[model samples]
Target: MTKFASLKSVRLAGAAAIALLAGAAQAQNSPPGAEMATEAYLRAIQEKNPVLHAVIAVNPHAKADARALDAERKAGKIRSPLHGAPILLKDNIESNDGTATTAGSLALKDNVPGRDAPLVKRLTDAGLVILGKTNLSEWANIRSNHSISGWSAVGGTVRNPYVLDRSACGSSSGSGAAVAAGLAHLAIGTETDGSITCPAAINGLVGLKPTVGLVSRTHIVPISHSQDTAGPMTTTVEDAAKVLTIIAGSDPADPATNDADAHKTDYAKGLSKDALKGVKLAVARFYTGYSPKTDAVFENALKDLRAQGAILVDVKDFDEAPIGKAEGLVLNTELKADMAAYLASTDPTKVKTRTLADLIAFNAAEPKEMVWFGQETFEKAEKTKGLSDPDYLKALADSKRLAGPEGIDRILKETGAAAIIAPTTGPAWTIDPLNGDNYGGSSTTLPAVAGYPHLTVPMGDVTGLPVGLSFIGPAWSEKLLLNLGYAYEQATHHRKPPAFRPTVAP
Candidate 1:
């Protein structure tokens, strides 16, 4: 019994839940370090919160550490904002003793790195407990073009707690949805592109995609060293700031982290409800007007920011020039080399797919894996030369030129903005099995391709689905964007838990 045999197993179970637990709804709403809020439902789903609980250590760790935090509170010491909190960690992040760092693929089942990813260790030291591992898109959704976001061959499908039919968003899907569904107060998510921000946006959680070097990637699964980074996904900007402080630093193991220690602020220290005052922001108009409804939410958010003393500049000069296509080329070329290196270091046995080629073969053998999407992305990557290739070099150069200096940097320099803003993504569309995702434009590509930092706060809602307002800026600007985000979050308070709709009938 791997917990769930199918998605339909809990459809009625979830719907019926809202009916019987009317009174207990508010009772289950316990904050991180608050007194026990009458453990009505949280206890029942402690270990059974399969998709949301990212690690298996939650029970033992939560039991012991939570009490310790409570004792500290009684003794007048609140270790940190997340002092008595529980968090889920993505499968790929290393845990010193308890959980294995498999990246949701069987190839590295025994590849538990025997130490927490440096970022993970810092958070635990700050008093956050590792509850369990949330399933992720296998190899962070790099396996095949047809790959599903939340589905891993080892962990199966991590259903959206809000809707049994809709997607949970990949790579960091579990982490995003877990925190959104209240399985944990926070979770660790890694991203190369839309991995962290996309999921967080769609799931209505706050996600911080730090600059590539801000958080160490050591002991975690590798995507592309140039783009991969770890970040926090939490219910609030304040909590996200707390987690960022604990996890961010330069690591000797990850050379890319050399500049991180000096860059990241105790981000929480600067979070203020009034920091949005007199701030200048530019909106990438090209990324907007995709969905009239999402635009409506974003439009309202603009008004809110203005009311809060922020200036919104409708910058039409921001480039949207075919960046995604170019970035795809670089990802394919780099994934082949980076993933191969990571695979070579892992144990071969017990691994479902070893090399990228082997994984392709496995998917071919199992049609279900190839049914939803094709391995086109993986196949293309296989054909790409190493980063040293002239074509690869050209694509990389063009990306930095267009997405960086000529892109975000150019806009910031011209506007003198504290940050640029956009709709993180449109509202969650109806899940279409035949055609796949039908969402609108996303603001992730620019920041993602540039390896710059991007943070999203709740904007508002569209037919009850959440919309995220993104604040993107140059490297190490996470603190500035976070402060502006915190100010907006505190002022608007747009975040709301999902109602678990079965499907949005179109």
Candidate 2:
């Protein structure tokens, strides 16, 4: 049975508005063109956004851009299967469109560069419409340790579409919620660690954090230069693969992506339903068993994989304490350095928070910025001596060594497994401002710290909330992981559209 059938149907209250708009737009004699599709989404946002707060700004040029793409199609040009499809950019990613890349902060509300990030350029070149920018955790959730995941000063909090009171986990929250709710076909989200995958899992979407250097991190707001990368967040693994194909190439401005051109490929073409058959997958048992409900769902998913002829290997004992300890130091040290560099790149008049100290003072003065939480994390980053400091350097080297060579690599070699599997995270927790995020479990650190690829696909729900199955692989293994995820996704058919229930009692 399809997993969704067994799940209760709690229909969204505001869905009629979008449904009516979709029907009215496509009810015409001719096929619904890009213009019509853009219009429908624009109208959908108007009717549904007040409740969800998913989108920060709608692109003023979206209709005009769609019309242009339609004219091109009429003139015998179709860039790809996704040509003219509307996609949202997480507010941290800059685009040439009129929308400001605010990073969900009131401080950078007017910090519009009016230039596309290299990845955004690639998407536009492929004829994808820039529908708008979506909200996010303020400053990508780096300001405070006690920060709320989906709340932001500029765009407000992003509500999970599955259950309105649930948290849409971190940084990429709006992008995840918007795509899951059908606000857009896909969205681009940046991740320093679990930012992309967490929100994607909680919101019941497919999120792929590619090998760090595979996609350029040129114009997105900074967190950690060594770890940050932009990736696709979509409802389907195929859509994520398609977006990765377009965006995976070298950018001259980003030194990290120097080898990207050599590694890039048509990722979507490599997918096969039989890819998982006879493949040995290492199950990261340490990452599971946090929530019994989530583990139960994962066990059923494992059964589905086994039924498909995949071999599951159990390798349970690995200590993750050193990696976690080292990662915090590396992130704090790099954030101070990378943030200053990015701020310097911005126009001086538009962005006044030119240094970490400047941002700290701004938050101190602005009541809205500090009303919900404090900027203790930012202050700690400011106190770090420099990226060149001995302790910081030691932490950086130690983290990479522990997470990459001694970590995922050693496990794979010992098990002779193609990849590692884990529960991406537990189901979405309640949105709480008083105490901040209460995570049940996460398997994001190994892949994230190692700068390897991690793909998360919806496995099933815990109660009324969704959880994701994670595939973790070595560097530049995005294609392999995608194929594996696609195979599992096709076999299970697990993804379900959100019901937008007010809350789940359990």
Candidate 3:
């Protein structure tokens, strides 16, 4: 059996990577050579990642890759605006950089496929350096309902950068924390529901969970094919837009992305501070009032939008109970099928857990895997019938319908709004391993199940823990959502770097 190395032990590899870059010769100062910038980022990760537990493994080849990119830059062949920028990927995203793409699961510690996921390929082709893999909730937080967010057996618990003892939120916990702490220029995070948005909001960054098919899901660890997608988690909305433009294209391997090329555009170019002028936005009243403090922050955010000459309409009558029930069945059914498919695609010798059942048995025998939480959710997924089962098919259809045309679109038509706005989620909660995550209100479900684009920008802080304001639109409306978010972000710059305090006072 392959044993996963400790996160502390992994730091040694990152240290060696920095050491390798220390010898790179042809360094430039104009906009900084890729090698120079990569070395600085590696140093920051080496210094801060130990405390934050945000990085799973640093790309040992990063400096070499940076050197190559610098050579290209010297040849006057720039790739994109993000040329030479170092970006971190959530651990689930595969790359051929020698680091294993563990979903923070010991079962996949040796699952180094030596191939880049389609999105990673796009990033590297555009001259972005693959910095490292960020830790995530084990199996993207689907192991159990009682499982703790940001806690993984392989990488330990990812500490929130703002209030170290609070939840960073996952399974994009490390990506959010890493970028918030300035460990990377940008990070890629995948979301099924609130993974990207919650973490980015709580960590004081911008998170975009694009429409389901807008980005390729090939080679990623799977939960549900219907809802999974990789998106940008960055400190600025423009950075998110820049990343989206590069990664949003059709992948032959992913049939869902067949229409992606048609919808893809230069998202960053569409951003303008005047994008919101005269635009009417539907306020998702249904998603507010979870936290009084969060509501207060949201009210101020609305005022900011109003000050920008925008009309806000309150949309209060939306029920999520049926959608929640339907989504549960759909996710469970897809998990059993999709996990098996992803496992089969892995190197058989390296990954022995080839099926959901195998994973369940492996977890039962692995003491550390169960130390923080049980695999009750896995058990539930295992019991689910195949995808062709009528119950599951019905659930999938109903979920998409109720959350899409009948939900978000209906609200938009009735309110005459360009997009819907709400509090992304409440502030970070205290990290309680024994009790698990106490998540508050979230506006992730409607857009998530609907396969619509959702963007979360830093709104403000509550007791020093940051929160985000959400901008949601119909499917393939990523460009519109990004522009709206950019406008708001410019009008009220609420994002700030984390203080890294041990805890926040009540």
TM-score of every candidate relative to the true structure: 0.86, 0.94, 0.94
Per-residue alpha-carbon lDDT of candidate 2 for residues 1-506, written as tens digits (9 for 90 to 100): 14323222212322332243234333433343677667767766775678889999999999999888777766667787677778899999999887888888878988989899999999999988899999999999999989999899999989998998999998899999988877877899989989999999999999999999999899989999889999999988998999999989999899999989888999999699999999999999999878889999999999999999999999888899999999999999999999899889898899988988998998999999988899999999999999779999999999999999999999999999999999999999888989988987699999999999999999999877999999999999999999999999999988898887888884
Best candidate, lDDT = 3
True-vs-predicted CA distance for residue 230, candidate 1, Å: 1.1
- Model 3 lDDT per residue over 37-93, tens place: 687778778877878899999999998998888787667677887777789999999
Please, what is the whole-model Cα lDDT of each candidate in the order they appear? 0.74, 0.88, 0.89
Candidate 2 lDDT? 0.88
**TM-score of predicted structure 1:** 0.86
lDDT of 3 at 5: 23
Model 2 spans with C-alpha error above 4 angstroms: 1-32
lDDT, candidate 1, 423-466, per-residue tens? 98877655454565565668888888888999988888777778
Candidate 3, pairs of clashing residues: none
Residue 376's lDDT within candidate 2 is 98
